[model samples]
Target: MDVTVIWAAIIALGVLLYVVLDGFDLGIGIVFPLFPDEDERDLMMNTVAPVWDGNETWLVLGGAGLFAVFPVVYSTVLSALYLPLVFMLACLIFRGVSFEIRAKANRTKHLWDLAFIGGSTGAAFFQGIALGAFLQGIPMDGGRFAGDAFGWLTPFSLLSGFGLVATYALLGCCWLVAKTEGDLQRRLRKLVWPLTVMLLGFIALVSLWTPLQDPAIAERWFRSGLFWRLAPVPMLVLACAAWMRWAVHARHHRTPFIAAIGLVLLGYAGLLVSLWPYAIPQGLTLWEAAAPRESQMFTLAGAAFILPIILAYTMLGYWVFRGKVRHGDTHHYH
Candidate 1:
């Protein structure tokens, strides 16, 4: 691969890494309040405490890869998705504060708890919106961004925003079941059903909207022969989800959670394949917007070294925190 292609691969990998790493954490935050019971909340928090911060490294890696390698794509995508980006950044900030403050506050931990929810929701929803907009393709002019500031706020974007939120929440609940037991686990099982239902509904709505928004996308996926090969991804994901639903209710729990993660991975891979070779959906081909070869080589060298180390530490953190979360008696955390 040339500089542009290699760098594109790096950044794309970074984004996928972020989706896999922080994805669960964000999902948990969105689903946290599902169980209003304080004990359940503690159990849920414990499940993520050891690794949430580390999970955010993927976001950093993705951002840095963009800045270092594909500066053009970064600038254009950010400029077009400025509103959603700002919303996402603000959510990350609030969520971080809430994470620490909730553990220290004496009387008003409830406020921090609420902040976590808001931040997580804001971050997850805006991310989905941005994803939808990107997939819809930005309007580019002379190799730069030329999109309306509010172009991202279409109905399709909003629908995608909710779809991601629901998707993350379901994943979060499944994580909770895997990490906790007793009343909390039972509560999570109950929660996953509605979230699952909502996920299916959102996907169906998006499916209907996709072809309407862009006939090309419709042809690529449904009308053209590509659908024969591409269609299996969604079908596999659906089968996995059905199996997860069955497993979650089968008095066996971990298998369902594992299956849910598999479903997420497969579905995401399908989207990536559907839009491969295009850095910005149908706009700006990857090589057309690539950075200098020397710059890419330098950045790749550093990432190749650092990425694995980060992955190792992330794995270690999870391993250390493995098992049931014990949040102590009814005392206020902060």
Candidate 2:
């Protein structure tokens, strides 16, 4: 195995971790406005409050790993999506601030609640837009970014943004079902089927749009000898979605959430496989975008130690807080 490939996989793992962990919390925020009952809303907030900040750590790891291991890819992609990235960061900041202050503000709690929802929606939208733009392929001329600033704003990007909003909200709904009881749980149960249908529709659209947008992706998946082997990917994703819907209907709260995570993981796997060897799809290969070997080696050593600690603590935190978030119960960070 090449060192560059190892680093690429490490970054991909970090990205997957961040998407799965932070994604649920972001989805919770996106669906915050749906529950008008203050008690239910507080329970929803309590479900994620203990580890929301820790969940974000995987994102930082992903970003830092990309910058360290693939400087060219980082510089190029970041430069191309500069404005949206800035907006995403701003939204994240607002969301974090709102999380810390919302409970403290007795009179202005609604204002903070609004900010949280807005920030979560904005962050998820722009992240999806950035992803869509990347899938549409970067406008590279002589190995440099040659597109205009607003090139990221396209029909596909907009659709992708909305798609992610639905996807995240579905995750949130499933999570609430797993982490709450009584009225809140029942309410979330009703949302699971509709959100599942909506998510499947979005996934279908994106799946079609992705191949059409990039001939390489289309050819790689449809025309290659590897196509038959990889064909099960979509099938498995859909199967998970179906199982999640069934689980929610059956009142198997934990099953629905687990199935939801599985669905997202399958989709992520399909994507990484589709774009394998290319850090910046259609342009830069992993080796091409990788930094100097010395830099990679140095960071590799640090990652070897730090990633385990992060993983350990993350698991421990979840284990500690593993229970239903009941209404009127005080949520303590132990």
Candidate 3:
């Protein structure tokens, strides 16, 4: 078997899982300001409190897997995007600390709330910026990053940053809709249509903007037979949006969240399609950036054993915590 391809698939899956899993929690922070009622905020935090930290495992997996199997990509990409990545990490740390402390805090709860909002918003925005910068292509010299410190700061990257914030907020809103009840759930459901519209706008902007910014990507999408084959992606996105709207209108609790996930997956697939085979967009291919065969084999063996264990535990956690969160529930994170 081509362990390189296998490893690539593994890393791709890990990153996608990370985005879908942790995206909502970070999103909760983004949407935190909308529902200012202290009890509503408490309930919002409660929906994710059980699974938020656990959801980040995929991130660790993706980052470590890249560092291990594609050190060249890791080093060069990290170097090129160092500032945004550092800011993203700092935001994640602040968000995590605030997530824990906010529950216990009384007067200082408001402060923690602000921290949580800033942290989550900062993290999501920077992540999108990193993604946009990477998509636009990293300057490379002798297999090293050849970009300046501010290379990642661009109009395209800034748009992507805000787009991601919208995406997460929508995701968080859908999650709250599924996991809360009564007035909170009603408010969340009300927010879902507008958030979905905002998210779709961002998706459309990114989709159109990316190809215009990168001729290669433009050609990839429109200049060949690949276009016809890839046509279903956007169609599917619209279908998912329709499904989410219907679910919200019908008051079906779980469907909107599921449909929201579908939208994220489709967007992710489009991105992967755009950047296919390139570890660093317009730079290195996966095979070209791969570590030695023996190292891949060793890591694959370890991943084979560990991934199943992680999957099992993650499934168990969700199953155990399954059900709508209501106010005054004694079983919450607080």
Candidate 4:
């Protein structure tokens, strides 16, 4: 292991961790509309309130890892994704404000909830667009994006954006099933059927698009044996997703959320197989964009210890707040 490889692994792990942890909370926001009544919405918000902010720790780590290990890549990517990045950040701000305003304001909490939903949907979709564009490779000059501001506004990117929103909504709905009880659980269960169908459909669309857009991907996928190696990931994901659907229908709330988390893990594993060694999909390999060996080693020293502490704290938080949030939920700011 080279220092660059070590740092790349660290960065990739951080991104995956962020996705698995924060994704459901974001999903919850996205699916807030699916709930029938106002109280259900509040309960969904309450379910995520305790742990959502904490889940963003991995996002910070991922951003910092990129700055430390691959500043060139970061500069290029951020430049390329300037508009989508702004959209994502704006959504995050609106979401945070929604959380704050909803708790503080008594008469107009509904507005805040709507704000949160819009923000979450906007953020998640724009992020997917960013992913689509990165995979599609932007033209670069001197390690910076050399294209129009609307460079990411492609048909494929928009489709991926919506797909991500759908995925998050499904994740959120299942999370509600897990942490909620009574009416909320029932409502979430109702969502499982339609959402599962949407999830499968989105995956199918992405599968079709991937090979068509990048023939090299299809070639590499089947030729390098990576596809076979990674086949178990999607197989396990689908199996778990099926079990989750069944669990939701069977009125087993907890199992569905667990299965949903397993699917998220499986998705990350599949991505690792799909795009290993590449920091920017088809364009930049991790080693090519990685910082010097000494710089990477220095960052690892801090990351090695900090990441475990963050994980421990997150797990402990979940352990402590392991229960359904009732309609009349109180915010206990820690």
Top model number, TM-score: 3
lDDT for residue 190 in candidate 4, whole number 0-100: 89
lDDT of 2 by residue, 218-310 (tens): 999889887899888878987888898679768996998888888788878878887887888889899988988999999999999999999
lDDT of 3 by residue, 203-317 (tens): 9999999999999899899998999999888899999999988998999998998999999899999999999978888899989999999999999999999999999999998
Output the better candidate (1/4) by TM-score: 4
lDDT of 2 at 73: 81
Q: Give the count of colliding residue pairs in each prediction.
A: 2, 0, 0, 0
In order of TM-score, best first, we have 3, 2, 4, 1
Question: What CA RMSD would candidate 3 show?
Answer: 1.0
Per-residue lDDT of 237 in model 3: 92
lDDT for each residue of candidate 1 in 1-334, tens digit (9 for 90 to 100): 5767666676777777677667777888888776687656666776777788888888888888887776888899889999999999999999989888787786988998899899998999999999989878899888888878998988889999998888788888888788777877787888877777787788778777877787667767787787888767778868877887788679576776677677667757766766777777777677777787887788888988997899799888878767666566224323
Candidate 3 lowest-lDDT run of ten: 325-334
Give the TM-score comparing model 3 with the true structure, all chains together. 0.98
Comparing 1 and 4 by lDDT, which wins?
4
lDDT-wise, the better of 1 and 2 is 2
- Clashing residue pairs for model 2: none
Which stretches in model 2 have alpha-carbon errors above 4 Å? Answer: 331-334
> What are the candidates' C-alpha RMSDs?
2.4, 1.3, 1.0, 1.9
